[model samples]
Target: MALAQRRPPGLKAVVNVAGGLISAIAWRRAWMRSSRPSRHWPWKDTLPQLWVYAGNDDLFPPSLVDGMRAAALDRGGDVRLIALPDVSPRGHAILQNGRARFVWLREMDTSLRA
Candidate 1:
């Protein structure tokens, strides 16, 4: 999201994995919007963006993911959210999970190609 927000020249697509504005602690405390929306979260529709979340993520759970998706859409940001199956030991590490790499890669490829 940080990279995407920079709006570098020729930026086409963005893929965010296990990323969200609110931290785990803040989310647990029922304070998802405890502070101003970070500069990282979606603010505008500069490009196509994909959000990938692990179904079993302990930190950013489904509720948080849904809230984020909703907020992005509300803000007129072009984004899509893809929730994958539980990814081993820690869903948050899906990027490092060899077995799950293919899944996210394939999804990104198809979405980007569209």
Candidate 2:
């Protein structure tokens, strides 16, 4: 599956909006400094999972994904990285094209039969 890439303009606007929202909600009591919250791991350590990341994602920089891969490797977990060359985050739209959709379906069919 192709990674969902956010356009540059869309990415910038989303970041700005998120920052503004965070600032506006900063005064809420739920985020007060006195709150002691328990931390929990959502996934079991034994589960086999694949982490798919894009190298040219505008929302998430390549360095962040590289760091995640390094951390996962350190923990002895299997990490599969899929990097597309000369592609922007907006390239995800290609998946929506009829030809691309047909190719994706064919790949899925082959995988399932195997």
Candidate 3:
């Protein structure tokens, strides 16, 4: 919501990095609402979002993220996914290291600029 408010009136973009199942559920709900015209959509705009995940994340697997991305896109919500190559216990850790942290920053910057 903070991000949406920061954007221009008709522009909405989000960057989700190394999120867990809870995050996935929220997105699924959003997509479900987007598909149902009879439902009340609280937002005046649909947000385009980017999801970044570790390839071997156990908490939120790449496959799950991919599925969410597909569903969001199908609902006409802009979404993208980037899976980093690594099999580590850092499944839900976006700031595991300097480089990983940098990726989050870069994605956020890119999203805000768009």
Q: What TM-score does candidate 3 get on C-alpha atoms?
A: 0.63
Candidate 3 local lDDT, residue 109: 79
Best by TM-score: 1
lDDT preference between candidates 1 and 2, better one: 1
* Residue 103 error, candidate 3, Å: 2.2
Candidate 3 local lDDT, 29-77, one digit each (tens): 5645675532322234357677788877776767666666565555566
Q: Rank the candidates by TM-score, best first.
A: 1, 3, 2
Clashes of 2: 1
Per-candidate clashes, comma-separated:
0, 1, 0
The global C-alpha lDDT for each of the candidates, from Candidate 1 onward, is: 0.73, 0.33, 0.61
Worst 10 residues of 2 by lDDT: 12-21
Q: Whole-model lDDT for model 1 versus the true structure?
A: 0.73
- Model 3's alpha-carbon lDDT is 0.61
The list of candidate 3 runs beyond 4 A from truth reads 1-11, 20-45, 87-89
In model 2, which runs have C-alpha deviations exceeding 4 angstroms?
1-46, 86-114
